[model samples]
Target chain A: MIRRQPPALVRRAAGPVLYRLARLAGGPPPGLRRGRDFAPADLPTVVVVVAGADEGSCAEVLDAVSRAQWASDAFTPVFVVDAPVLSPFRRAGYVVELAGPGGLGAAVAEARRSYAADLVVVAGGRGPEAADALTGLLLAQRPPIEGPVGRSRRFLRAAEARLR
Target chain B: MSGAGPEVGRGAPPADDVDVLRVLAPDEDAAVVAEELSLVAETGSRGAVLASSPGLPEEVLALVRRGVTRVLRPGEPVRAGAVVVGTPRPEHDLLAAVESPVVLGRAELPAGAAALLRALDGRLPGGRGNGPEGPDPVGPGPVAAGSSGRRRVLLVSSNGSGLGHLTRLVAMGRRASAGTDVHVLSMSSAVPLAAEGLLPYEYVPSAGDLGISARRWNVLLHRRLGEAVRRFRPDVLVFDGTYPYRAVAELGDRFPGVRLVWSRRPMWKPRMGAVQLGLVPRFDLVLEPGELAADLDRGLTVGRGDALPVRPITLLDQHELVGAAQARTALGLEQDVPTALVTLGAGAWHDVDSQLGAVVAGLRRVTPDAQICLVRPSIARSGADPGHGVRTVSAYPLSRYLRAFDVVVTAAGYNTFHEAVAFGRASGFVGVTAQLDDQPQRARWAQREGVGVDLDPLDPSSVARVAELLVDERARERCTARCAQVWPGNGAAEAMAAVEAVADGASGRELLGRAGASEGRGGREREASR
Candidate 1:
């Protein structure tokens, strides 16, 4: 199980906090892919949690972000999925780690604490316009958040303040 | 008459004592809880029903586990503060149970049962005074002044390799509906088909897919099962599965009013062993859906004198089948071209698409004019393009369009096998993986009975064999003739009658063996007269 855990760099971005929360929600079932180095650790992590499944398209978003200003190892863009979509990111040569089974709120809260997340982005659901705005702000490296970002920002703000 | 109804529900809502929950014990008008909760569910009301079983009925205890209704001791205070029916408390103060329990002085439960039902209904969000409500009136169907009457049948089925268990439940539920209201609770994703077949159904989702610990899944299932029982207040609960779950025993002992019938199919492979057999006696009755291979059955669970065996039950009726020309037009094939429906059943669950693709592709070569249609409609929805010029037709009960095809190539599943034989549609069985149901055994039986052909689905030449059998008029006619001789179209009716008989207190091996009626009906009738 330790061998399957995220690499040292990923462990740095995602503290043991997320695993504890997932354990409470009954953790990922057997065979669910564990953390595989998703984003770089040098930059403050920007955890992107996909609320609905459709993780492939979202992985493409992360891939696009990494190619642009985000830079592979700059700001860690950890994807928090309900289920895993590791292969697409792996194929695209982007380091995409996953934390799951826990709902989005729990995943984002833990991400904020573990990474001192500079921003948390939620995108890819029913609203297309909102997804575009978040995608734009994220690629452009906005603050903890400003565009159409939803509830996770409040959690990140509080976690950042508490850390300070 | 409802004076003995057990009440167990959760806490009362704020302010109004009438804001109670719904729990149904054996002696109570079971639909009363469903009727009440259906309202609360609609009105967004949140609370539980509170009632006490001084005798502590097993039925009431089970409801407590589901948190459907709160159970109280004989003298314990009612928590939900719902209606006080009859003389439940000869010892305790009703006022202590709640700020104001609805206790009617000298009010006969037979008389107040109506008002008690209405009081709970009136407290809902869009009550008579609150706003305009929908068509269904809240309470139990307006009972005749002195009659404690209402009948709800609960049909529960476990997931099988295919729709066999669920389809049989659907057949039994539809037949049971002729005399009683029926609701189905299915543990398969295909549960939506129940609604399409015109039965009210709830999908519990198969536990196998949850990826959780067994203990946790069991607890969740126990609570869900209890809640379904409480909501439906079924007089008869038919659990149709290969092996009975562990909770059925406890549930049976508690709900004395619910006549538990184990609606099982025959053909359990000898290797499955007798572990499930030990639990059969826990049910009020064991219903075995008769198979063509009863004589060949080495299954330990079914076919004993203690179990009732009816004709092979199927969801399709002969009269309901679409005419070949109409079905052909609907399916978009020319009348002149031969059509073969490769209805492999839920074998699609396995990674057999590539294998089936080869079989169908091979089939298209043998019978060039034949239009091949794969029966896995869900494949396209799952985004798998089964593109070899074989379109996917997803119509429910595929039996409705049985006439459209000259032949059907399918898995050796009970529903498909029974329907094909019953409808006299020539078919060839391509055996699929089944954990307990021995499809291979049934496939051989079907072939020997002259009703179908069977072969290993993966065999390279199996497609040619299947295509040849379908195109051969003589072979197809022989198969159809054998089918016509065997199917009696009485399985569902006989099963329903037997189930009702169990509810009416009929038991013993003699009663069970009487499943095949005196008229020598069912397949026997087909041989003798039809």
Candidate 2:
């Protein structure tokens, strides 16, 4: 025999109960996540890093990196991506690499060691939880990356003179 | 030089069997013919003497021999391959002797003679077919029997302050060339007509050098004009404006056959001294455009017709206006704004400044939204401010800019006034110079016909009145329509016909007789007296 459930009781039980479960479990949604970031210091050379889970996620990472490189000053870009994302970056003419699953912290450190990097940038997160965690870790280490704030102001001044 | 009739050795070669030869003489026609004949003979060719007559004066014969190769008398037989040369009279026996040969005459030769000459010279008849022998039929020798020849007219204009008279005469000369040649002998710069290819001209000493002023220059010019008249020997002589009266007198005496004409477009009282009037009768004809014929004294008036506009209104093409637009755009004007053109014909020592001020004020009031282009004779003296909706340009080619205007406000210089009328635009006339005797009359006439409005420069109210009228759409339309009826821009054709009639010695007497008959008419008489 099938037992009939009361709708009002079910609705009341679901919200608070799920919230407590998720706080303990700490897992993200099932969709693949992808991200990338770039900074160009030498006008003709750019640097990029990307992270993703699946092929589609890796493709998204590469596309984002390529667009950033094209928009920046004309440059040969160096890319560090998740192992699965490297093939697409390589096809796109970037000096590329396979990053292990620990995300871009090690990649940023390696880029600084291997190439005399003028800037360092980070991008992509599985979700808000993972993004928040990665940002917190990056803040603690403070990689030797030159930020875009001062450079953006200088570019703006040059652009303004050209317009006049 | 190969084929010949009876061989006559040189040393004033006998006029028996030769076609023609050049010799020096005072007679220019004979000299011209001799020169042409010499050119043909120097080419080393034999030509037939198709016709000869003792009636050709010895002076003319002597002139012809200087260039002619082999001139043949009436009964002389021409060689088989000779170029037959002679007059057009069919009775000449030498024409029958040659199978086909080149011929000579004062006018173009008859088509039949040209055909015959071309055939005998081993050239195709009609100058189009192939020849079995001799050179290809490049063209028929100048068929001189009936060809319409050029009748050269010389126009002498003074370098006076205004170009009104000179401009009008230039138009007349251009029109006169329909069946004749025209050469202008200007004392001033030979206007832009040369660049336009309208008339060929040369410059003489300035009118000032001809003693036109209160000084001794008039006497010097009188003598110089006489010398020029003797030198140019025109078929017809035209004196534009005044100060060439003594020259006209001298031309009458020196060149008795030449028809001496004067083109007068003055609107003011004659400032010419009393002695000047005595010389007026010597002119063979005085051509005045429009009702001006009525003003000329009896017998002096030879032709009366619509005067040709001094500026070519219809001739100002779209390209000229487009160029002006581009220029104005470069000078920083909004290309879309309605433009108004204001001009005062080269101002004399009159109330030019005051007149210009009134026009500026009126233009500002009427065209608050429009750009005003003031074409000043002297931009420095006019002192118009750019802030008052006015831009002063020194001497714009007015006809080119006239097309850019919805309306033109100007003084009654012959050229400016007619340009407005010809282009079918609304105009306002500000009478500034009493020296231009025609201005007041033209202005009144234009007003009556509703083609233009006349503002009295002396009256402040008149300026305001014109300013108010400028904004009236109906008034502008009415004026433009009326102008079309009065001056349809064919005055040049009429003037040409009148000139042709006079030059042909046909219509001149009738025109003069009509003028004499109309003497009793009080209206024209009154205008003349004024």
Candidate 3:
């Protein structure tokens, strides 16, 4: 039970690839798995980690969240950021929190606690196309257990469980 | 629930009402624009979009003043269910091209538009401009000044560990236009403005003081600031703080009609340089109080064109200080003995104990009978006792009694540096390590200018250097001469004039032009000095 966590760079690099794999292997509808045929009155929230130094990449990730096919309120995005976010994101109604010295994981944890979010997502990609490619995967996620469990890990865990 | 389902719109659809409304009408009449904006406000629309066009800057300003939170640009993409308003002309092509439903916008809220708004309103949670907990009934613009014909200015200062922000605001308020009714609204516990003759004070505890989350604190700030805006009906609200809170930025949209000015000082740490720069546009005016070491400034506010740069704002004018003998007598110090004041600020941290000991020990080595006064800043929670003989004095507006000390030992903060140099006091500067302030840079600048000696706290030899500087008559004379030569005139009067002008609706360009003139003169002086 002593699995080592991957380095942040490796996790970041693997994010989009994992998103595609998860989407291609879609399971039951996210709502049905939660035992509700109808949409929940209150949407679950997600702490999206907009980390790293690239502003454009961060914007693309946010764009992906905005374009996510779920209801406009499908999941409220509380951005845990390590980079400078443009004012437009704020105007777009995204709540942004600056990541502290503990880096992206700490920021995600703090954001989740502050916002009472059910899940976390690492919003990183090579470009706008990658962001677009991951939109469906972002919406089709269920709540993971506690701690800074990002989308890549959640997908990999589900895949591992299926193999078992 | 499965996250993937039939396309039933993004997120669960709200009961009714639109999330945002987009209007793309160019060259519309002023009355029509006003009515449309009013309807936007009345419905508490979360955001609005207007067709950007020529002669629309004022319309944009008016819309902002009417309390519309987010106004999208023509090409900026919005989520589904946003109702677009305007005929599909060449100018409106981009906005109309969006997939959302389009409807013709009228001066009056049309039944079709109302229904569309209802549909969008329920689409997003908390889709209200002035929320339920927010102050009700958005009122008219700048009410009359009660027969005085003078405008009212509400000066708000953040809860800084020192009185730097509060002092700057007090300086400006005291010098406001003769009949202008000025009120002080602050979150700082230090409200000694009454001593400076500026009355009508309101105090609100900061998030730290209340031990509340930032979200809750923002809500509290919104409620309190809203209440103040309603009560004071200030023509301009000038916030003196490092970080302009979300509530402060939302003032234009929340209360409407009140002009917002941020009175920020420079000399921030390099790490804190650009994180908050984006919030600059939120203010109608960003008034930067100039620093003495402007040329040597390495902080974030350097070379910024958006802010109007004024000369260093000090709490008291040079002439306001009492003569040395009278100042000494006022502070209960012996008139004949050599005296030095230590104002390193907030003795609770930064190894102030060692710094204080070094300075006191150094001054005592030169003149055993030297009188030393330590200025305990009003905000310090607790401080290390400076042992037996060092006199601990707490004074608000300490600038008024600067002449009490023959030599001054202090931190290189904005207010203290300007006052020490302006008063031509022989001084020694110590740079405290602060997250937001570049104190070492300031201390070095004073040393470079030959106005003061920079003392290094970690260097044990600094003790002897302080003693040498204190006792060296030639060094004292050099400091006095250099201070007199380098001192810039007080900018409080000019800053107040700019604040009042901004209150009367002066554009940032106009004020910046004046700042440019000052900067130009300073540049000329630098060239002349070379």
Candidate 4:
């Protein structure tokens, strides 16, 4: 029989172990924990989303996240690249192009639905208007995983473990 | 054993029968049995036994088993025979009944008794484990000249209130005097002299008497500081505060032969509006402690040293620092806990309350477990109470506490800043006094170098941000490493060499001619040279 440990001890041990495993796997650890009854059906397909007013910044974020090990088999990156440059990411097999020429809020919602994304990673300096819009949307949705992009892989791993 | 009835003392007496006894000395067997009986009475059971006793006192025998039966006669033999007890026997009745019993004969104790006594001595109230005997002497040795016929250098800092300027002067004097005579002139209470062990000149009276408004006491104290210079005439006069500008300028005119040097710490803004306006010019040579050179553009427009003087005058440096673990052990602190040091200059300002509050608040948010130590130069005199979670140490040698810190949080005072940078302790600056704008400016320079963060002492958010940055292990390590990179060692020695060259008149005419010729290039080139 498996002896049960205290919840506090299990939580403490789980975070560090998960972080180590994620590091070994060369990816940011997933921070959220699933319900006891969670199954394959409950697992929302993951996607990395890049939102910014500047197309250059958005492309950079898309390029960085796609290159990460986590984006390999674990999640698909949905680059909501503005109309300017959609070809580079499309050719990379990661793009699920959203149809309207819309602002950040529309881009985030469109990307989230199109890719069935469970987590959102925003990158680049979008000025105050985009920041407010993104913040408002994120707050309303209350996504299980969210953070600034371009942060170190180690920080992402730590953040993921904490959320879990 | 089957035939044995309830045993009575000495003879086969009836259980209900009573008998009075007078136990005498020298009856070993009987005394042992009587002692065992006493033990039974005391413990309320036969848990204890007297292995052997040479004699028994009459008073003790009478009181034994008092509640149960009468005492037995002394000549009566013990029916129980000699009882052998456990090594640690139970309490004896002889000791219980008699308040104070004086036995006449010599008492023989077991061999283990001596060892037991020794063990008890280890736990005794007064013993050898008292804390390290007394305060260790921390002051530096007397300033000595390295070469014979070396010029005597007198460094007088009239920057009363805060000893930051004064401390830098002392460190500079100590270094510069390696080939020259060094004396310090101060109007500060005798404490600085006593702590530094320097020859002090006469004291100037209150700032009010020196024509400085009570509001601007720093300026007034400096006005009267010229008295010290006049008294201790020397080859080189070094002034280390902003207030003593007029006095330093006057001294330069009064004794043209004497070299006047001003060591300016970094400033956030100019101290004197008039000086910023180019109304008054002070000092033949100005020494910028750290990166004051970068901010002031090497004192080009200000008529001061253009480059920062690289002097070997600082106490906190890599070679001087004790290893972090060793320092913690020496200071009796938990080896694992992160330590942070907070310090302010000697001056006691009215706004100290707010500044200290901000620091405490920031510390609470960032690293609550981080050990915080507050070091003030005049800890003994200021009596400034650093609140909870803060340990206040007097003007003990900074060298002792320098290595103990993983990070140092302090106001932008010149001496402490230089020390913090030199020692590679991740430092954070909180601007305290506006009288010396050099502090905030210095903090900015340090921030630019990635050595530390500069936070507005008055702003709660900024303080909290600094605290957050300091607690993060990665940030702290990177900052300290960067600080070590920026500050190469031996600044004090270099500054002193420059001062010595000027004092010997070798660089005087050349420097003056350069100062007069290009005016702009000379000052900037001079600073850059150092």
Candidate number of the best lDDT: 3
Q: Which candidate number has the best TM-score?
A: 1
Q: Give residue B398's error in model 3 in angstroms.
A: 1.8
lDDT of 2 by residue, A30-54 (tens): 0101122333222322234444335
lDDT per residue for candidate 4 within B203-285, as digits (tens), equals 33223212222322332223233323343446677776654545456665545656677665544354344452241244566
Better of 1 and 2 by DockQ: 1
User: What order do you get sorting by DockQ, best first?
Assistant: 3, 1, 4, 2
lDDT tens digits, residue span B166-261, model 1: 888888777774557778777764565544547877654344533223333344455456656665677778899977776565576545667788
Give the per-residue lDDT of model 3 (tens digit) for B412-510.
877788888988888888888876878888889888888887886535466556556656778877888898888778888888889899877798788
lDDT of 4 at B27: 37
Deviation from native of the Cα of residue B90 in model 2, angstroms: 74
Q: What is the TM-score of each predicted model, taking all chains together?
A: 0.58, 0.45, 0.55, 0.45
- As for lDDT, the candidate ahead, 1 or 3, is 3
The DockQ-derived docking category for candidate 4 is incorrect
The per-model DockQ list reads 0.02, 0.00, 0.03, 0.01
Tell me the alpha-carbon RMSD of every candidate: 18.9, 40.7, 19.9, 33.2
